[model samples]
Target: MDEQPGLSEQYRRVSAWPLFIALGLPIAEIGVLFGLVPIAIGGLLLFVGSIAGIVQESGYVERPWNLLAGLGGALVVLGAALALSQLPGFSPGAVLAALGSNGLVVRGVSIVVAGVIALGVGGAARFVEQEPI
Candidate 1:
């Protein structure tokens, strides 16, 4: 009988965050280019969440909530810009029209939605505490 030696020690540990992040970016790009709102939003969320996970795993930050919140804020602003820039005017009618038929507006809204989720998750994580009794 023979047994494997040093198998445990030689085993390599890998993180999935980097891979998901890589995949997410391209998916997001494709979605944006093709005007696919759901794809764009899903990709953005996956990418942003992966980043936070990677940062936390790397020990660079004690908590990823802050980073998530920051990324979310940036996304919110960027999305707002994209959504607003398409508008010809600030009138409610114009807004409705753009929202109904504009791809850019749709993408922007998707981004904003992802951002808000990230922000809320991040902010809410801050308040979570685990106590061992």
Candidate 2:
């Protein structure tokens, strides 16, 4: 690439926004879960992150932001799992009786699956970014 100038650099900057935001994910989570900030901000971050991941060149494929997103998302799901284990609706033995009785098992399983998938995707993205262009 020979530096196309103007639009190219602009796009590059735009592309980097997600990487920047990924680094700031903790703040975004805090704003949404703890600070009680506007959902709009959180929603915007999620939307931009998704779009940036898809459209931008992301340098290669090993994008750190993508990896972080996947890992961080998985961690979020894991935390939920730990918290759910304590809830009266479910336990190691049974989910208020049986895993299927309350039907929470399905949802829990889905969340864990989603988390794993996210982690895989994020790791792949990071790999792409780190690879030789």
| Candidate 1 clash pair list | none
State the lDDT at 55 in candidate 1.
98
Candidate 1: where is the Cα deviation over 4 Å?
1-12, 89-94, 131-133
lDDT of 1 at 51: 96
TM-score for candidate 1, please give it.
Answer: 0.81
Per-residue CA lDDT of model 2 for 41-102, tens digit only, reads 44334543554464445544534466446554754576357447646664556543443443
The lDDT for every candidate, in the order shown, is: 0.83, 0.49
Q: For candidate 2, which ten residues in a row score worst on lDDT?
A: 35-44
- TM-score, predicted candidate 2 vs. hidden true structure: 0.36
Best candidate, lDDT-wise? 1
Give the TM-scores of the predictions, in the order they appear: 0.81, 0.36
